[model samples]
Target: MNGYHILLVEDDSMIGDLLQKMLVREGYQVTWEKDGENVLDIIHQIDLVIMDIMLPGEDGYQVTKKIKNAGLNIPIIFLSARNDIDSKLQGLTIGEDYMIKPFDPRELLLRMKKMLENQYGTFTQIKHVFIDAEHKKVFHRSLHQEVAFTAIERKIFFYLYENRDRTLTKEHFFDYLWQLEDRNPNIVNVHIKKIREKIHDHTGEIIQNIYGEGYRLNTHMKK
Candidate 1:
């Protein structure tokens, strides 16, 4: 598997730099974003985002909410100094994984790695083939059905079907699509929404949301 692309959104330069370095040393591509204003613009470039709840302007909660509402399936890990239950719950409500600040950088990396691994793993053998990268297409032999997919929809399906039964982080998807470059999360959201629609149209089973982690492909054969 390829290394993950990470978005480190922290206002504190020291913390951000430390995390960035750690992630880099671990062989993952890291993009450090200190400003909240530009976060939305580049949300699509990374596989996952390590966000600080206390940002300069918009803050992490608001950012997370926007990402989810936009239909992006990228996983967010909240790294904040606030350890209160309410804060944690709020972060979770917005579909982000939470981590308290003054935390070990190594631990953060481990959590991120685990989260990505869970979402994007390995593929299973099913008779579906000929996926349209721009349009989601799934051909099932048993059902004798063929479905069309949107661009983003196709990417998600291709990623999942290629790595079925595994956890895939938003970071992983971004890396696959944009490599290690920095971009916007909104781009990811656009693709995820399209992909979800295509999946529901054909399979009828909603792509499993790992909750604060990312998305997963349910390999259980549908009847």
Candidate 2:
């Protein structure tokens, strides 16, 4: 499971039901509510929100303001039928994004994923490991224990993760870990060896050695 929870505040039964099902199918936990009522009661449990502008009582904008006023930093995307520029502007100003009704579900889903990743960092399960960029930690899926790392190892791991798929040179690590201090390039190799061992990547599968380039974290590993 993706393991992120979403709060869907949509009054239309058909739309809410369809969205809830799609989100669930995409491996997200969803809480569907018809209106803004009872939002605060369970807002803490929500990781992100899909809001509707028109509702039985308080509108999405008002509800969003209240949530923000309460010092919550949850990301929200306004989904509504209103296509007017004014409505879109207001929604965009208050929420992270705005999607008009009759929108493509695929696009909406993609946006949700990007927003979640941007806000909470890259969280994905790949094979036996769960990389939680937000927490700066990795967990063994079956063992149910965190993959411990040294301070410098953790920094290097996350730096590679945050820049996944892009080969980071040895100089990048030296600059990141100790600025202006020339350190042995082999030190990076040593730390990477331990990191790979801890994460069970003995064959350089996930953390690939790019020949003469450097190292890269390939997060697209099959689950």
Candidate 3:
């Protein structure tokens, strides 16, 4: 956890800086590359890669192919703005995960943790619902394609998944995600509603509102 080295391939200075800072805070050594050229040069030192799709000269797909062709086995997570199914499918074939842009910091952290631990095993199976944490995606057979979730939605889903048996109050999420003790916590309600709709947990919403005590993932939910 502390000594892990990650090569970050992102061209946008602002996004790259924020991601680097967050990963460093989580105790990982990050060697950031703006373009796709130097990635091959430094892949030997990296334990995992968090790459952006739209890079300088070469896109993520090309760079990933190069790395794989060279026989460097590494977990690559694609963090890009391309939310299309085609893009997701193609990236997933080469990389470990394909995350859409405007991602939650916590989701990225969790995926990175999972990818780093992939040598041991993957996350526990949650039935049909595939939590593509590395990709920051969530989907099931009911939805033929991936259900896009915003940064907040991913945070909510991941939190509920981790603590599936427990009820989480709005204040809990507000404090944990937003890192603030807010005055109006109804925004949490809005997010919960959206997550339910996107994932298609209608009659028995996977996220059940506790009427008075916030919400929790319904244990009765399908496998």
Candidate 4:
């Protein structure tokens, strides 16, 4: 919910700024692009793209076509002023979705959510025992306990959840905590212990150590 990254490509300054602000207000991390040329630079980092049909350098169709051809598979929804059948067909055929200009902002948000849900697993479905990335909080229903994380703790849990597919070494956590070359890797152990305590995971260590391999989250993404 909070961490979904969206790419907004619109040439017009006014429209682009407005759309970016709206998307941000809705909790999406919006990356604004003024031209189609810059799409490639941020495409790999974004979850979705909301583009204008008429771009300055390269048109929306051309940019989307290139993205699809590249097999990047990032879903794109065209937000254009061109209200023509041919335009709709071409954009839909080349991209994942399309939406006309002068449309409701709420509807745009809903479509973005749908595209994201279809692409990645739903946020609610992927919850850990007490880790809720969507709401950016932690809670346990059975124990009737809910505790919030500090900024650093939240980052640690989020990173662990995202990379739960494999064991995460202490070095991986050290890199996230500080840019300082002198930061000690032992700090990872301290924080990991704190996270375990806060979540009341005393009996079962959900994020268990993998012996020589560091650590891994013993949780699976719910289908």
Candidate 3 lDDT for residue 55: 85
The window of 10 residues in a row where model 2 has the poorest summed lDDT is 137-146
Model 3: lDDT to the true structure: 0.79
The per-candidate count of clashes, in order, stands at 23, 0, 2, 0
lDDT, residue 136, candidate 3: 57
Q: Per-residue lDDT tens digits of candidate 4, residues 64-158? A: 88888888988899988888999999989988888888999889888888888788645432233444577676654311244667889888887
Better of 2 and 4 by TM-score: 2
- lDDT score for candidate 1 against the true structure: 0.69
Q: Quote the lDDT for 125 in model 1.
A: 27
Model 2 ranges off by over 4 Å = 126-129, 133-135, 138-223
Candidate with the greatest lDDT versus the true structure = 2
62 Cα displacement, candidate 3 (Å):
0.2
Task: Give residue 177's error in model 4 in angstroms.
Answer: 29
Q: TM-scores of all models?
A: 0.54, 0.62, 0.54, 0.59
lDDT of each: 0.69, 0.88, 0.79, 0.76
- Which TM-score value belongs to model 1? 0.54
Q: What is the C-alpha lDDT profile of model 3 across 1-223, one tens digit per residue? A: 2546788999999999999998888867789999899888878877788989998788999999999999988889999999999999999999889999999999989988877776423333344454555655675532224678887788888888778879998777877788744547678888888888876777535677888998988656546
Q: Weakest 10 consecutive residues, lDDT, candidate 1?
A: 122-131
Task: Give the residue spans of candidate 4 off by over 4 A.
Answer: 124-223
